[model samples]
Target: MAAGQKLYPRATVKKIVKAHSKCNVSKNVDVMIFLDYVLFMQTLVKEAAIDSKQAGERGISAKSIQKVAPDALSKFKG
Candidate 1:
Protein backbone atom coordinates (compact mmCIF):
# COMPACT_ATOMS: atom_id res chain seq x y z
CA MET A 1 0.00 0.00 0.00
CA ALA A 2 1.12 3.54 -0.66
CA ALA A 3 2.07 5.79 2.20
CA GLY A 4 -1.07 7.89 1.83
CA GLN A 5 -3.36 4.96 1.18
CA LYS A 6 -5.67 3.60 3.84
CA LEU A 7 -5.25 -0.06 4.75
CA TYR A 8 -8.89 -0.43 5.75
CA PRO A 9 -11.88 0.90 3.85
CA ARG A 10 -13.75 3.78 5.48
CA ALA A 11 -17.19 2.32 4.81
CA THR A 12 -16.22 -1.06 6.22
CA VAL A 13 -14.68 0.46 9.29
CA LYS A 14 -17.78 2.57 9.88
CA LYS A 15 -20.01 -0.45 9.43
CA ILE A 16 -18.00 -2.44 11.92
CA VAL A 17 -18.15 0.36 14.46
CA LYS A 18 -21.89 0.68 13.98
CA ALA A 19 -22.44 -3.05 14.34
CA HIS A 20 -20.49 -3.21 17.58
CA SER A 21 -21.28 0.24 18.95
CA LYS A 22 -24.96 0.34 17.87
CA CYS A 23 -24.74 4.03 17.13
CA ASN A 24 -23.50 6.43 14.51
CA VAL A 25 -19.96 7.63 14.99
CA SER A 26 -18.32 10.85 13.83
CA LYS A 27 -15.86 10.87 10.92
CA ASN A 28 -13.06 11.91 13.25
CA VAL A 29 -13.75 8.96 15.50
CA ASP A 30 -13.67 6.64 12.52
CA VAL A 31 -10.30 8.01 11.47
CA MET A 32 -8.92 7.50 14.94
CA ILE A 33 -10.15 3.91 15.02
CA PHE A 34 -8.65 3.25 11.62
CA LEU A 35 -5.28 4.61 12.68
CA ASP A 36 -5.31 2.53 15.82
CA TYR A 37 -6.15 -0.62 13.90
CA VAL A 38 -3.43 0.00 11.31
CA LEU A 39 -0.83 0.72 13.95
CA PHE A 40 -1.68 -2.40 15.89
CA MET A 41 -1.38 -4.59 12.82
CA GLN A 42 1.90 -2.97 11.81
CA THR A 43 3.37 -3.48 15.25
CA LEU A 44 2.25 -7.10 15.32
CA VAL A 45 3.75 -7.84 11.93
CA LYS A 46 7.04 -6.11 12.72
CA GLU A 47 7.42 -7.96 15.97
CA ALA A 48 6.61 -11.27 14.31
CA ALA A 49 9.24 -10.59 11.65
CA ILE A 50 11.85 -9.89 14.31
CA ASP A 51 10.91 -13.01 16.18
CA SER A 52 11.23 -15.06 13.02
CA LYS A 53 14.74 -13.76 12.33
CA GLN A 54 15.88 -14.31 15.88
CA ALA A 55 14.76 -17.93 15.66
CA GLY A 56 16.81 -18.46 12.41
CA GLU A 57 13.77 -18.52 10.19
CA ARG A 58 14.15 -17.35 6.57
CA GLY A 59 10.82 -15.54 6.68
CA ILE A 60 7.98 -14.71 8.95
CA SER A 61 5.74 -17.69 9.65
CA ALA A 62 2.44 -18.29 11.36
CA LYS A 63 4.33 -19.70 14.29
CA SER A 64 6.09 -16.39 14.78
CA ILE A 65 2.79 -14.56 14.59
CA GLN A 66 1.15 -16.93 17.05
CA LYS A 67 4.00 -16.52 19.48
CA VAL A 68 3.77 -12.72 19.36
CA ALA A 69 0.02 -12.18 19.08
CA PRO A 70 -0.95 -12.33 22.73
CA ASP A 71 1.67 -9.84 23.80
CA ALA A 72 0.85 -7.55 20.90
CA LEU A 73 -2.85 -7.66 21.63
CA SER A 74 -2.33 -6.84 25.27
CA LYS A 75 0.01 -3.97 24.49
CA PHE A 76 -2.42 -2.49 21.99
CA LYS A 77 -5.49 -3.20 24.09
CA GLY A 78 -7.59 -0.30 25.26
Candidate 2:
Protein backbone atom coordinates (compact mmCIF):
# COMPACT_ATOMS: atom_id res chain seq x y z
CA MET A 1 0.00 0.00 0.00
CA ALA A 2 1.20 3.49 -0.74
CA ALA A 3 1.77 6.00 2.03
CA GLY A 4 -1.44 7.92 2.94
CA GLN A 5 -3.55 5.65 0.77
CA LYS A 6 -6.87 4.68 2.26
CA LEU A 7 -7.73 1.02 2.60
CA TYR A 8 -11.43 1.81 2.94
CA PRO A 9 -13.22 4.28 0.77
CA ARG A 10 -14.37 7.45 2.52
CA ALA A 11 -17.89 7.31 1.07
CA THR A 12 -18.32 3.72 2.18
CA VAL A 13 -17.15 4.52 5.67
CA LYS A 14 -19.46 7.49 5.86
CA LYS A 15 -22.38 5.39 4.68
CA ILE A 16 -21.68 2.73 7.28
CA VAL A 17 -21.44 5.32 9.99
CA LYS A 18 -24.62 6.99 8.89
CA ALA A 19 -26.48 3.70 8.93
CA HIS A 20 -25.38 3.01 12.51
CA SER A 21 -25.31 6.46 13.97
CA LYS A 22 -28.25 8.54 15.07
CA CYS A 23 -26.35 11.81 14.51
CA ASN A 24 -24.35 13.03 11.55
CA VAL A 25 -20.80 11.74 11.27
CA SER A 26 -18.08 14.35 10.78
CA LYS A 27 -15.08 13.96 8.50
CA ASN A 28 -12.71 13.56 11.42
CA VAL A 29 -14.92 10.92 13.01
CA ASP A 30 -15.11 9.05 9.74
CA VAL A 31 -11.34 9.10 9.41
CA MET A 32 -10.87 7.93 12.96
CA ILE A 33 -13.29 5.06 12.51
CA PHE A 34 -11.56 4.05 9.29
CA LEU A 35 -8.18 4.08 10.99
CA ASP A 36 -9.48 2.05 13.92
CA TYR A 37 -10.99 -0.52 11.59
CA VAL A 38 -7.77 -0.81 9.62
CA LEU A 39 -5.76 -1.25 12.78
CA PHE A 40 -8.12 -3.93 14.07
CA MET A 41 -7.96 -5.87 10.82
CA GLN A 42 -4.18 -5.61 10.70
CA THR A 43 -3.88 -6.89 14.23
CA LEU A 44 -6.29 -9.72 13.53
CA VAL A 45 -4.37 -10.81 10.42
CA LYS A 46 -1.01 -10.65 12.18
CA GLU A 47 -2.29 -12.74 15.07
CA ALA A 48 -3.83 -15.28 12.69
CA ALA A 49 -0.56 -15.53 10.81
CA ILE A 50 1.30 -16.28 14.00
CA ASP A 51 -1.30 -18.83 15.05
CA SER A 52 -1.06 -20.59 11.69
CA LYS A 53 2.74 -20.69 11.90
CA GLN A 54 2.57 -22.13 15.40
CA ALA A 55 0.34 -24.87 14.03
CA GLY A 56 2.85 -25.54 11.25
CA GLU A 57 0.56 -24.26 8.55
CA ARG A 58 1.95 -22.68 5.40
CA GLY A 59 -0.59 -19.83 5.41
CA ILE A 60 -3.14 -18.16 7.61
CA SER A 61 -6.37 -20.15 7.51
CA ALA A 62 -10.02 -19.58 8.37
CA LYS A 63 -9.65 -21.70 11.47
CA SER A 64 -6.77 -19.62 12.71
CA ILE A 65 -8.77 -16.42 12.16
CA GLN A 66 -11.79 -17.88 13.93
CA LYS A 67 -9.67 -18.94 16.88
CA VAL A 68 -8.16 -15.49 17.21
CA ALA A 69 -11.20 -13.36 16.40
CA PRO A 70 -12.82 -13.34 19.82
CA ASP A 71 -9.63 -12.32 21.55
CA ALA A 72 -8.94 -9.68 18.91
CA LEU A 73 -12.44 -8.25 19.11
CA SER A 74 -12.32 -8.04 22.88
CA LYS A 75 -8.98 -6.28 22.78
CA PHE A 76 -10.21 -3.73 20.28
CA LYS A 77 -13.70 -3.35 21.70
CA GLY A 78 -14.53 0.15 22.99
Candidate 3:
Protein backbone atom coordinates (compact mmCIF):
# COMPACT_ATOMS: atom_id res chain seq x y z
CA MET A 1 0.00 0.00 0.00
CA ALA A 2 1.08 3.51 -0.69
CA ALA A 3 2.35 5.28 2.43
CA GLY A 4 -0.60 7.65 2.28
CA GLN A 5 -3.12 4.91 1.64
CA LYS A 6 -1.55 2.66 4.25
CA LEU A 7 -2.52 5.19 6.87
CA TYR A 8 -6.22 5.26 6.19
CA PRO A 9 -8.70 6.37 8.86
CA ARG A 10 -6.13 8.87 10.06
CA ALA A 11 -7.42 8.73 13.61
CA THR A 12 -6.68 5.04 14.04
CA VAL A 13 -3.51 5.12 11.96
CA LYS A 14 -2.20 8.00 14.01
CA LYS A 15 -1.85 5.77 17.03
CA ILE A 16 0.76 3.77 15.16
CA VAL A 17 2.37 6.75 13.53
CA LYS A 18 2.58 8.95 16.59
CA ALA A 19 4.07 6.18 18.66
CA HIS A 20 7.01 6.08 16.28
CA SER A 21 7.31 9.75 15.47
CA LYS A 22 9.86 10.29 18.16
CA CYS A 23 12.93 12.55 18.00
CA ASN A 24 15.30 9.65 17.45
CA VAL A 25 14.66 6.31 15.79
CA SER A 26 15.97 4.28 12.88
CA LYS A 27 13.72 3.78 9.86
CA ASN A 28 13.81 0.07 10.59
CA VAL A 29 12.75 0.65 14.17
CA ASP A 30 9.78 2.74 13.10
CA VAL A 31 8.71 0.20 10.54
CA MET A 32 9.00 -2.65 13.04
CA ILE A 33 6.94 -0.78 15.60
CA PHE A 34 4.22 -0.04 13.10
CA LEU A 35 4.09 -3.67 11.99
CA ASP A 36 3.85 -4.78 15.61
CA TYR A 37 0.99 -2.37 16.21
CA VAL A 38 -0.91 -3.71 13.21
CA LEU A 39 -0.48 -7.30 14.29
CA PHE A 40 -1.44 -6.46 17.86
CA MET A 41 -4.68 -4.81 16.81
CA GLN A 42 -5.50 -7.74 14.52
CA THR A 43 -4.97 -10.28 17.29
CA LEU A 44 -6.90 -8.15 19.77
CA VAL A 45 -10.02 -8.11 17.62
CA LYS A 46 -9.96 -11.83 17.00
CA GLU A 47 -9.43 -12.64 20.66
CA ALA A 48 -12.20 -10.30 21.67
CA ALA A 49 -14.54 -12.16 19.36
CA ILE A 50 -13.50 -15.48 20.80
CA ASP A 51 -13.78 -14.25 24.36
CA SER A 52 -17.24 -12.87 23.76
CA LYS A 53 -18.35 -16.18 22.34
CA GLN A 54 -16.98 -18.03 25.36
CA ALA A 55 -18.92 -15.70 27.62
CA GLY A 56 -22.14 -16.64 25.82
CA GLU A 57 -22.53 -13.17 24.39
CA ARG A 58 -22.91 -12.59 20.66
CA GLY A 59 -19.26 -12.55 19.74
CA ILE A 60 -18.02 -10.30 17.01
CA SER A 61 -18.07 -12.77 14.17
CA ALA A 62 -15.21 -12.37 11.73
CA LYS A 63 -17.36 -12.49 8.61
CA SER A 64 -20.01 -10.26 10.09
CA ILE A 65 -17.44 -7.67 11.14
CA GLN A 66 -15.92 -7.74 7.66
CA LYS A 67 -19.30 -7.10 6.12
CA VAL A 68 -20.29 -4.34 8.50
CA ALA A 69 -16.92 -2.62 8.60
CA PRO A 70 -15.32 -3.38 5.29
CA ASP A 71 -12.59 -0.89 6.02
CA ALA A 72 -11.77 -2.83 9.16
CA LEU A 73 -11.78 -6.21 7.39
CA SER A 74 -8.01 -6.21 7.19
CA LYS A 75 -7.88 -6.33 10.97
CA PHE A 76 -9.98 -9.50 11.05
CA LYS A 77 -8.04 -11.63 8.58
CA GLY A 78 -5.22 -14.05 9.20
Which lDDT tens digits does candidate 2 get at residues 1-78? 999997768888788878887678887787787679899999999999999999999999999999999999998888
Cα lDDT tens digits for candidate 1, 1-78: 778997668888788889998988887777797689899999999999999999999999999999999999999877
Name the regions of candidate 2 deviating beyond 4 angstroms.
Answer: 1-27
Report how far residue 22 has shifted in candidate 3, in Å.
9.2
Candidate 1 local lDDT, residue 11: 84
Candidate 1 ranges beyond 4 A from true positions: 1-19, 22-24
lDDT of 1: 0.90
lDDT of each: 0.90, 0.90, 0.58
Q: With candidate 2 superimposed using the best TM-score fit, by how many Å does residue 39's alpha carbon deviate from the native?
A: 0.4
From the highest TM-score down, the ranking of the candidates is 2, 1, 3
User: For residues 1-78, could you state the per-residue lDDT of candidate 3 as single tens digits?
Assistant: 766565445454445656766544444554665687787667667666765677676767665444445444455444
Q: What lDDT does candidate 3 reach at residue 10?
A: 40
Give the Cα error of residue 37 in candidate 3, in Å: 0.3
Model 1 TM-score, all chains together:
0.70
Best candidate (score: TM-score)? 2
Model 3 C-alpha RMSD vs. true structure (Å) is 9.8
